[model samples]
Structure formats: C-alpha cells, structure tokens
Target: MSTNSRWWFADLVLVVGLASFSGSIALTGLDGPLRVAFVLPLVLFLPGYAFISAIFPEAGNDDTRKFGSDKSEAIYAVGGPERVGLSVTVSVAIVPLVAAIANFTPWGIRVLPIVIGVLGFTVLSALGAFVRRWRVPANQRYSIGLPKLLFNSVGRHSNGSTTMVNIGIVISLLLVTSSVGFAVLSQPTGQQFTEFYVEGQNINSNTNTFYQSNLGDNGITVNVGNREGEQTQYTVIAVLERVENGSVTEQNRFDQQQVTVQSRQTKQVTLNGNPSLSGDNVRVRLLLYKGDPSGSPYRVIRLWLSS
Candidate 1:
C-alpha cells in the first residue's frame, strides 16, 4: 500500500490519523476508541516525526546512508551538528508544554481541543521543516542522518548487526497500539444517575412531627452522582406536598437548586425544613432532571416523612 519505501511510515501514520479522526465523529457510539487511537499518535509520535523530518528531510538518499562502512560508519541519530540535538530537545518539550497551557484555559483539558492543538502544531512544524529541507543542496542535505533512523530504519539496514534494534521498534509500536485499543473498549457509555439517595441527618422526630430548623437543614440531604454521558445543566426540586381526599398538591417547596454538572460529576443539594411542612399528611418528593423539570427525570426519590 506504500510507494516510498524510505518514507512510507510517515505516510501511513498520517493516513491512519485522518481515518481515526473521521471515525470518531461519524461512527456514533464507537467514537471513543477510534479517538484514543488517533490521539496517542498525535500527542506522542506525530509531532516528533515532523520535527525529525524538518531536521533531516534531505538525508534519506541511500548514498549518504552507505557513505563509508566499517568503522567509518553511518551515524544513527547523532550524525548532525550540535543544533540538531538542541532542536530535538525543544521539539520534544513543546507539545507537553502546550498541553499544560491548554489546561489553564476555559476548554479545561478536553480531548477535542488538545488533539486539535497538538496536531496543528505538528503540521506547522513539519511544513517549516519541509521548506528548510528543500532549500539545501541535495549533496549538503545528505549530512542529516536521523531521517534514516526514524521512518525506514529496517529497510535501510544492509547488514545483520542492527536486526535486533529494528525488531525492538516494531514490538514497541505494537504494544502502544494495543494499549489504545484497550482504552477505547473499556470507556463507559450512556447516561443516568450513578447514585441518588437522601439522608435526613438533622431530623428530629417528636410524636409524628418531623422538623428541623438548623443552620443548614432540618430536612433530607440529597446526594447525586451524575454519570449522565454529557456535560449538562440539571435542576433538583424537592416539594413537600399535601394529599387531601386522595388528591395531591404542592405545599412547601424546599430545594429549587439548579447546577450545571459535567459527566461523572458528583453533587450534593439539600431540601431544608424551611418552614417545616406539617398537618397530618405530607410527603417529600425530589426529582433530578437533565435540562429542566419539564422533561423526563433521570431520577426520582419520594419519602413520606409524615403520612
């Protein structure tokens, strides 16, 4: 599937990255794993590949690689000037630094923005490297040797001594690929309340009258763990209702709390004994919603504090 034996590896990586990025958007539920696969290379290898390319774009010619064998050998990666090593150091540090900076912004360490930033950086660096490489004379460009090592390490080898190194590279790449696959398959999917329960901590009961007027609440404390698949706004409404002649109506509204929660975020809201709803028959009803109370609830818990 590749034509350039020496630089086909880079082509394959870009192609696969494009495919994964597309799949993550189009495939609906299976987007998680495909995205993981794409992001690993974007963050880890792609930028470095571009940096290496810029440093040694013109050096892939075979004559330079086999210039003089036996003791006066081909330099593996350290063949270039001191600037090469300095460039390498800076290139390696750039992406992680970008990621740390990205976290401080409003995007807040999300996959989409991060993947976009890293990939964009990689591409721009690569284009600069390309322009620089083409400007140098062909014979002069032959001095850069890192490109020989990066994209076509195995095929470039004319001897058996470096077989072990090539094998190690293949094995390491496979292990990383497998790890991405595992991450995609293991990610949780869908939305619903992970946990919802009410605890009446400060509840004081005296002869059928359940009442509390503490600084926080004399009513139940509602805990919600929102594992609901998306970053969404939610409202928690707790109403103390009265039932007369087998008909129910709202009497005292305790908690009308509204919060915007992220996926897998946990929150706690209290339904206080604000006025201590009483008078023979009363029930406390709590509902957790995704957007508003008009929609169907993700969870509902009803308790008869006094019936």
Candidate 2:
C-alpha cells in the first residue's frame, strides 16, 4: 500500500486499540491492569507512524507542498473546527472513563490517569495537525512532518479551552466534596447532665449578699469579683443546691463560678443547667479553686451532666 494509506491505517489501529482497552477496563472494573495496558499502545503508535512515513517519503513530500506553502499568513491553523471537534470528543470520552475509575477508588486516584490521558491526546493531536497545516507549503501539506505541524497548530488554541474547563471542573468538584464532608460532621449523639447551683455571699457579714435564682435548671449567672487589682483564675469544683419553704430553688446560679479576675476588675459568669428553685429562701454554695485569681487569663469550660 502507499505510505499515506499505511500512515492512516496505523493511526486507525492506535485509536481503535486504545478505545478497546479503555472500554474493556470500564466494563470489567480492572484498575491496576488498565494502567499498564495503556502504555504499550501509545509507545508503539508514534514510532509506527514515523516509520511508515520514512518508508514512503512521497506522502511526506505531498504534505510539505500543501501546508508549507504559506509562511507569512496568520493562519487559524491550530484552532480550526476539525481540531476542536477532535479535542471535544476526546475530552467527553474521558468523563465516563474517569467515572468508572472513581467507582473503584473512593479516593479518586484512578480518575487522574484518564484525565491526563485525554488531555495529552487532545493536545498532541491538535499540535500535530497545526504543524502539518502551517509548516508545509499549501501544495505539500501531506509531508512526513504533517502530523507535527497539525498538532502544533491545534495545541495553541486547545490549551486555553483546556485550562478554563479543567479549572472550572476542579473547583466544582472541591466545593461538592467539602459540602458533603461538613454535613457528615453535624450529627448529634444522646447525652445529659446533673443539676446544681452556686450562690454569692458577703465575706464580711457572712450574710446573703446578692441572691440570684436557679442557675442550673434553666441557666446560671454569676458575678466574679476582682479585689486585688490583679489577674485571677478560678476553677469550679462542685455545684451546691438549697431548699426553701415548700419548693426547691437555685439560690445563686453560677454559670462560671471559678474565674480569673484582673486586679480591680469583675465580670459576670454564665452557666447552663437546670436548677430547681421555687421556694421562699434558698442558698447554694459553689466550691472554687483560685489560680492566678488576679490575672486576666481565663478559659471557659462547657459543663454537661452525665445521665
């Protein structure tokens, strides 16, 4: 057969071989073997095309006459419709292959090869077609270097489209993945806590000072005093309860009993819990450990009752 016919046949064989292998892998769900199977065909095809062209220099001569005829014109030789069409076909085919590979790997590693392969094919094909159309004279467009010329031309245009498409797809994928991850993290587990209260008293008179109601039942609020003009830290050790007339009520509700106080500074403490305070008189004591009680450093602890 003529060199041109041989070259075309080789191209057809390579394309068919790759397509068949890809389809088989997709159908059979064989990931590891597929990765290796793709390499040999690619290696063989390029050399085979070159060898065929060398043997039939007449075909190459024709390509040169047809495309190399123009050196000065700003030909849209790279991004022509035919090249664009081929690239689109390759890209579209890759999506399904990627999906199939992704089925095998939740991590999505398998999909990467498909994407790379598709992109490489599109780029190489476009470039080859472009070089063929541009470097050869108009009459000698079928030269041995035609493939290179065609690819070079098409490569320039497809690159811009490829970049835009790839970036958009990647960003969309990341957003979807992140949203799913966040949803999985927001589920609740069952748990409950015990009720308690804290009361404030005047150290001088040993008398009830500022009496506050149930601090645990609903929520507790306490005012920490800083007398020494320094920073202080307090740790709440226990919750105390008080009983009155006929019902029980939280006397002093301390959301935060133990708190660090800056010298001469005082802040209100708030705690969440169910305190039963529904009587005439009630007093609750909160045991506290003071640490650097005169410092401005403080950390909030969330208390939960174990039920």
Candidate 3:
C-alpha cells in the first residue's frame, strides 16, 4: 500500500477500536451481546496494542514475529526486545490502574469511566505511534504485522498443508467464538439495585453501627445502589413501626427523601427522625421506591436498632 494509505489505515485501528469501546458504554442497558461485541477487547488487549505501537512501532515491521524463531527479534531489533516487552506489559496494566483510581471517585468501576480512561490512553498512544512512524526513513516504513500475525497463523504449519491448515483455522475460530459467548454469559449483568441501612446522618455510606445518635433524632440514613445503566429516580422512606407476634401496631413516619442515583453508583439520603425511635425493639423499615415512594417499593430492608 502507499505511504499515505498505510498511515491512515494504521491509525484507524486504534481510533475505531476506542470509538467502538466508548460507544458500548451507552449500550450498558443492552447487556450481554453488546458486552461481547465491544467491552472485552477494549479491556483486555486494545490499550496494550496502542501503547506497544507507540513505543515499538516497528514490532510489527518486516523483521519480527510475536512467536517462534522471530520471537526474539524484537529484543535484537534497534529498539531491543526488552523495551518492547516492557511497553506491552505496561500497556496491559493501564486498564487496571485507571479502574483503581476511578473507583475512589464517584464513577466507581462502572463501564463509562473505565472506557473513557482507556480511550484517552488509547488516543494518546495512537498519537505517539503516528509520531514514531513519521520519523522513520521511507524505506523502513512497513505495514503492521498484527493482522497477519493473528489471522494468518490460525492453520498454517511448517509444511503448509491446506487440509490441516483449514481445519485448524475452523477449530480456532470456533474456540474463540465459544470463549466470547461464555465471557458474555459469565459477566455479571451490571443491572439491578440495592437498598441498605447505613450509619446515622450518612445515607451514601454504611457506618455498620446501629445505635448512632442520628438514628433516633429524626435523622436516618438509607443508601440506594443502582447499577441500572442510567439515571434512576428513587424515593427512600423510613417508617418506625412495632410488630407484636402475629399482629402489627402503631406505625409512625420518621424520615422521607426523594433522590437520584447515577448508573453504577450509590447515593445516601439522610432523613429526619426523632430520638423517640430509640429502644423497645422498634422496627425501622427502609423502603426504596424505584420511581415513586408512595408506590410499591422495589426493595425493602427491615432493621431493628436500639437508640
């Protein structure tokens, strides 16, 4: 291919791969199939590929192969294989590193933040790859070998027999397809929601303590967790009630709040209550309404706290 064509084509892999990855973030509601289509490749390999290309743009040049006799070529090449290997290794680590940092923020470990972080890295690396290639002499500019390396190796053997090679390719494709399907199925559907009692005055967090003074002073904490892939409205109502074996008596409302939680995040709402709720085996009920608190709750948590 011509130089201009090669440059444009080479750039497309990183550009489109990341675009596809980020686009999948919006598909969080679609679940399984979309996941297999986009998420895994971006998470597992694309970042590494981009970074490696940046540092070792020539790894895919005519001189090297990732396996067999050519495996050591990257080491012996002008850049040296060790540096190339390190680039590849660090590229892989980028995903987890971004995820760990994002988790501490409001984003958590959700699809959007992770994808954006990776795509940012991917774009930077792609730019580096372009610069690195641009400096190379005209004669040395070679096509990337990844496609040939992965797709071509499927069935060919030293002897190059067509029958065996064809069969091997078929088997390999089948395994890959099966693995992808399994991954999609095995991945947790980042859906559903959770409602739990939290420490007094902090609805967004769990204190794990029951007797918090805020629990009875017209103050209550209810945390609602949503992984529904979009902004969801929820109503949290804390009801103070007493149940007498096979009978119920005297229910009073202590606190109520309407709040919204982003997809793949948790939000806490501290409602108001009086200290009278303390002691006497009072049942503190936390009801989470998906859209309307007055309507049936999607989840309910009953906690018995002593003031």
Candidate lDDT values, in order? 0.56, 0.40, 0.59
lDDT of 2 by residue, 49-97 (tens): 3222222223233322233445422333222233323333344355466
For model 3, name the residue pairs that clash: 74-81, 75-81, 203-268, 204-268, 216-274, 217-273, 218-272, 218-273, 218-274, 219-273
Q: Which is the leading candidate under lDDT?
A: 3
Q: Give each model a TM-score.
A: 0.48, 0.22, 0.54
lDDT of 1: 0.56
RMSD values, in order shown: 10.5, 20.7, 7.6
Better of 1 and 2 by lDDT: 1
**Model 2 weakest lDDT span, ten residues long:** 189-198
Candidate 2, TM-score vs. the true structure?
Answer: 0.22
Give stretches of model 2 more than 4 Å off.
1-6, 32-90, 93-307
Local accuracy of candidate 3 as per-residue lDDT tens digits, 1-307:
2333355336436555665655566445545566566665565456666676566544333444444663433332223223323444565589789989899989799767877787788777777877776776554543444333333322123235744554565455456556766865664655455545565442323433355454655466567777665578888887877766745576888777889877667787877767444455566777888787665778877766544
Model 3 local distance difference test score: 0.59
Q: How are the candidates ranked when ordered by TM-score, highest leading?
A: 3, 1, 2
- Separately for all candidates shown, the number of backbone clashes (residues 3 or more apart, or on different chains) is 0, 78, 10
